[model samples]
Target: MTTHQLTEAQKKQWEEDGYLVIPSFFDKQETKEMLDEAKRLCDEFDVDGHPMTTFKTAADGEHVGDEYFLESGDKIRYFLEPTSLSPATPDTPSRLLVPPSQSINKIGHALAILNPVFRKHTLESDKIRSVAKSLGAQESPRVLQSMIICKQPRIGGVVPCHNDSTFLYTDPPSAIGAWVALEECTPENGCLSFLPGSHKLSRTATRFVRAPGGGTTFIDVPGVEPNEEKWDDMDGWREAPCSPGTLVLIHGSVMHRSPPNPSDKTRIIYTFHMIEGGKGVKYDEKNWLQPTEAMPFPVLF
Candidate 1:
């Protein structure tokens, strides 16, 4: 596979804005194949004995979890869009009935290890290593998680403002996300927005993990909460809408969010985060998602 490296100007922009947009990172053919693969996965997964437990967001906009949701941490599963369920009627038994055309929110967390197509694009590609080197990651970076975010038309849920390192955190916070657009993204279709220079402020404020009792929980960091005031200021933020094949590199500490889709178009994107796996950088064992013995995260050297 052909590899693309970051230019000096792009590296400078990343340093200043905590993000970099690489236009046409993938060709039209590649993007179309990826989108096709995503659609196939969403439509064909068999849930014979397993419960059809879809991911749901609470009223507070946090993810609601159960045993089924927690067990899917390292498995390929389909999560339904929050608004895809039909309301209960007098004849309907359950309130959450999957609509005729099922709206899937995402299919993720284990695609790189289980799916050959996704593995080729992620672990087998040299582009990830080249980008890591440009970001000054001396050691080989390891892929932590991979997910395809499907912002379905009209009913796509809003993702609240937050940094990625809070979820895929390592000691000293070396997480970075490579987000590839599989279709044209626009503000009307729930494209991502970023707070420039937010990474330089603080590494992380809180982390999301499985609680001792049950369900997912967000734990606060001891002495860090940078960008709270700046995050409140809306002027410094900007929307990053791009065409198909564009790749957006996100700094771990940068605050970013995407609004709900209000348009008829669907915004499909494949994203994954990488963390430095050097001797000194500690990947916390308590981070909720642990690597299985059969397939650990691939290292990109």
Candidate 2:
């Protein structure tokens, strides 16, 4: 079996292109464990007294933020599938079309520290930490965001093309996404597609930050306001298909998106972002997720 350390070829690919799809990064047992755990989380989640917020994305880059979203940084929170709900009236919220177990779009933000299973496979593994060091995380890499993106079956939730640094920002924009496939991901089932070398276009990205008055707003990135033109592709966009255990290391600035899962199979994935943390790196306060002293970002050792 190959070790988890980045090979010379993998390093060269990352250096030149800012993205890599490393096959079999995890073993079968490891992949199976995570998939089963994600299903268990979805099955055991209770809907009583919980907010039924649906995750929605716009073609134009505008994002909708609520208190439930803003406060989820330090906690494990569930977001409902936008397609799994009925239209809302004045008083009542959107009603769920499916049962609670199958209605979640994702569980996110703090799973690496809050959940033992994720923590073990994530922060606690020597192989994972070794990989982090190879990625230039310096002596310490602070992981603040971890997610189980459950591309729910058949509802057709599609994420528009966007980068990760827009949400998790640093001064020089240092965020690396560690995306592991828990099940087979195919183009037909909304697997990730990438515009390779897009990260080198601009280290500085347009951020989606918290607005002072209320809600969220886009700022800093030198460009026009939210519109379809921003999402227009120039060419060289390609789909990346993966089997179980494949790990795709994505540059925070690389433009990537997934189509709707028209097939019955769910394209579930486990992903987390690690940003450079130290004196030189500055994590902005205006970013969507803020780390309190009580729940500081977990460092990989």
Candidate 3:
């Protein structure tokens, strides 16, 4: 699980850009094994919404907006859209969701991922934490939210742009989200597009709701411009593209969204969020349909 320790230069880049791409962050063998396990899960699970194999061609022969046509998937089943049973709600207090793969091998791939490398990549890494401290973070962060996104091809829908801070009711108003790319990502393949420094802007949207047609949309934070160019110019506003072994570390305030997987291949990615440990922030678990703990698992520090 060893990796090239974060460098001073990379740390500086993260502080300035708001995000950094760490290449080859996972050991090749480990990555391969994880991918193998994901494939196995796809086979065993009763995938419902759209099979990860359909694609819609564009008039220009480009794969741009095709992702908006595919359906979203629940690891337990596929979803044509967000349902009452789904926890993808914005008003919800605690939104963390874990994958079903955790029980596969007992000490299987899931545990390996939760092991040192992945956790340390964002939590304990001195370089990353140093950058965080410079940006005002105190203490190591907790892996408060985690989930696996199994993006099947043509399984498209728009997860509109919004700040994660809006959903997390906390003071000092901050958190960190890391999205790991499990497959090669491209715009046509439904890769994520961010509004650059949109995270620094004041809350443009206060509530989250689904668009009439089907896609999800958020109410904009007052005072922010709907202008596109402003966000497009942010230092870290770049569209991140990665191979199977890269990770995207993002601040909680950052505004981001991704469309459906339009390509025939599946774009599987895992996402995790962490808050400064001992922050005293509590999650209202009473609303949960299932008996979920405030902090479901121990922070892997």
Best by lDDT: 2
RMSD per model, one decimal: 2.6, 2.6, 10.4
Q: Tens-digit lDDT track for model 2 on 1-301?
A: 2336787888888877778998888889989999999999999889887778767677776565888888888999998888888888998777789988788988988999898889988888877888877866456778878989988889858898888887788877788899999999999889999877777674454687889987788787564233333433658887899999998998887888899998989889999988888778889878878888899998775
TM-score for predicted model 2 compared with the true structure:
0.93
Candidates 2 and 3: which is better by lDDT?
2
- Scored by lDDT, model 1 comes in at 0.78
Each prediction's total of clashing residue pairs, residues at least 3 apart in sequence or on different chains, is 0, 0, 12
lDDT of 3 at 170: 38
lDDT of 3 by residue, 1-301 (tens): 2224566787666665556777666556656755665566545643234322222222222221122221211012222222112343567532213232221111111221243444444455554454445444436555544445665555444455555555433344556766777788778777777665455553433433334454333454454455443443355545677888777777666766676655777677666665555656543322111112432423434
Q: Candidate order by lDDT, highest to lowest?
A: 2, 1, 3
Q: Assess each prediction's global lDDT (C-alpha) against the native.
A: 0.78, 0.83, 0.48
Model 1 shows how many backbone clashes? Answer: 0
Better of 1 and 3 by lDDT: 1
lDDT for 125 (candidate 2)? 80
TM-score per candidate = 0.90, 0.93, 0.60
Question: How many pairs of residues in model 3 come into backbone collision?
Answer: 12
Pairs of colliding residues, candidate 2: none
